[model samples]
Target: MAAPILKWKRLTNATGPSPRPRHGHRAVAIKDLMIIFGGGNEGIVDELHVYNTATNQWFIPALKGENPPGCAAYGFVCDGLSKILMFGGMIEYGKYSNELFELNATRWEWKKLKPKPPRNGSPPCPRLGHSFTLAGNKVFLFGGLANESDDPKNNIPKYLNDLYTLEMKVSTNTYAWETPLVGGDLPPPRESHTAVAYCDKNGSNYRLIVYGGMSGCRLGDLWVLDIGAMLWTKPTVFGIPPLPRSLHSSTIIGNKMYVFGGWVPLVMDDVKVAAHEKEWKCTNTLGCLNLDTMKWEHLTMEMVEDSMPRARAGHCAVATHTRLYIWSGRDGYRKAWNNQVCFKDLWFLETEKPVAPSRVQLVRASTNTLEVCWGAVPTAEAYILQLQKYDMPLTPAKTPTGNPPLSPMKATGVFRPAVVG
Candidate 1:
């Protein structure tokens, strides 16, 4: 079988001042523009960077209103309006926040929302590495590390499995948070997992699909949350699944969810040492899950060595109709205190391609002649035709062919006016 064709091209000529090499940032597309905000390297980065997909240029717009302080690993989503909503992240190593902020895409302003009566008595705990997505008039948030301690000696972070939604009043332009009573089998508490909203064909049902993240170690589990029913279920899946990973990005395009680049731990023990030590590795492997069939397919691409981004985690990815944009992530490093390498470059994956022709037809023109027809292939320059004739099977009721009905005849021809007709 022929391998699937995929193309990855690193974007060049992104002019003007871009964000520094960082990770844990979030990006969202509004029309042709990509807005990137809030990541950290040496410290937290809170500035907003905008990239024009049409012009291939990057620029920072001066803003008004109160700006959120520098932070990383926050939840960000666009309301398909002029507003982009943000919530909950780590401002520093041991500090986390649950503040909500909005950015006016048109006016270039920031507004921190202060709800009079907070949802569920108070907002969700300050968190990082959570997944947030938009579905209809509501925004959903799930799973992240929270309640981190500032003390270096006891700096343990808490992972959560809770789910919350922000209900928006489109007419009045206000919103409220709601903690729905979810039932059924619940997934274990985890952080750094990714969730995407999937609406049914009739648009009557909405489902949020969650996949792969880390608890104490890496996890490769899949779960679904029915939005309307407020229930969670683990759907049985077929095909080879991706290995345990975290800090990856999953974007839904059509009936498939495309996952790109994350940290993968590889344990290597030294046999010679009395006390064997283990090592962790990271990868840039890419895969997709067929939502309709509940199957997983890992994609292998022909990538240029110099152009391909290194395997890393905490990066951000956003998808358009045909392309998946990956940008700004930390490189996979081994040591804790080692100077981490972050990327500022941008690259896109072209997931969709022209499909092969199908529904071929062969009509009998006469007793000894036939005409071949097929659907047009958009990317095909020409086509080939093959014809094979099999000998009739000998039976006891019928006379056996003496010469084995002669060798089956075979013919091959190029698809053209002279041959097809």
Candidate 2:
């Protein structure tokens, strides 16, 4: 059997108005359409761009109601209905907001939501570079940088580790914040991490899997939070792990969590250079985590240079049933200054399932000719046939055999047979 191959295809000739090159954007998939929200290039952007997966087109849809201000590093999620929920992000250099807004997917309208305060203290603080995951009717938010000082020159910011959920009240058309009382060990305060919701086999319990972030330094830890039990525990993971990174994207398909592209901080040997300058290393590597076996698998693809995307961070990735779409990220070219490069192109990572041909049959066509047939595999692009002759030796010596190798024959149609001599 042949190993399954993952292919990356760059989308071309996308029609309609394309969004400007920017990073720190947020995207969510609904059916065949992907909706992208705020990010920044020269400055912050508030325009909304929609990409149709079936048609390979892009368009800016006119929105109604009060539009949210231009911002980046915000949290966005689709409720699986026709609505997308957006939360905390930085609007500008010294500004961070905790405002919540909703986009009506079907009507193309926007509405600012004011959730009733939690029964306890105040709501979660204003932040950016956080993560949001939707499970059932609630959206979970965790870990981001909340600016504490008003001075724009003050680079140091406060990182948060608190977790909160926004529950929708359908009858009243409102939302309520709830801080669950969680037990067990919790992750440290960090920002620019990724979180994905995974359901168990029976579909009775849900878990939020978190991987990698930065808390003054890069992190490569894995933690899981049980929504029902209100517990947090670091799972024991096997296999080779990815390097410490932040600002990456993690998408869950089946029991696998696909992580791609992020920023890794660099340390310098010179004390003066280390103290005055800070550098980041961008990566294009991809990794997968198996939830069932608790193992990590790094995916390596063989493709041409132009076929793959550059090493980047602060990008957005959304997964469908069969494909993962990636777009718009900042590529830091390993320089300490003037190295930020924002992208405007789009790429698709195709994860094809392996399916072997079935109902195979063989028939003698002539004196030395034989025909082989099989049922077509829906997901397979090609098929392979192996033949062994009775006259050939069962075991080969260390010396060369000099025997002619068999070549593959191409057969078209669903049940077409290929003849061999």
Backbone clash pairs in model 2 (N, Cα, C under 3 Å; residues 3+ apart or in different chains), count: 0
| lDDT per residue (tens digit) for residues 1-421 in model 2 | 5555566778899999988888888999987788999888778889899999778899988789878999899999997669899998988876899999988988899999999888986898889988888976789999999888876467569999999999998899889999889999989988999999988888868888888888877788999998899899998899999877898999877788888899865654555543333676888888888888889875658657787888889899987656788998998665332235888879888665644554555543455676777775433445666555344356543435676433222222324333221
Worst 10 residues of 1 by lDDT: 412-421
Question: TM-scores, in order shown?
Answer: 0.78, 0.81
Model 1: runs farther than 4 Å from truth? 1-3, 116-121, 148-154, 268-278, 335-338, 354-421
Superposition TM-score, candidate 1 onto the true structure: 0.78
- Looking at model 2, which ten-residue stretch has the lowest summed lDDT? 405-414
Best by lDDT: 2
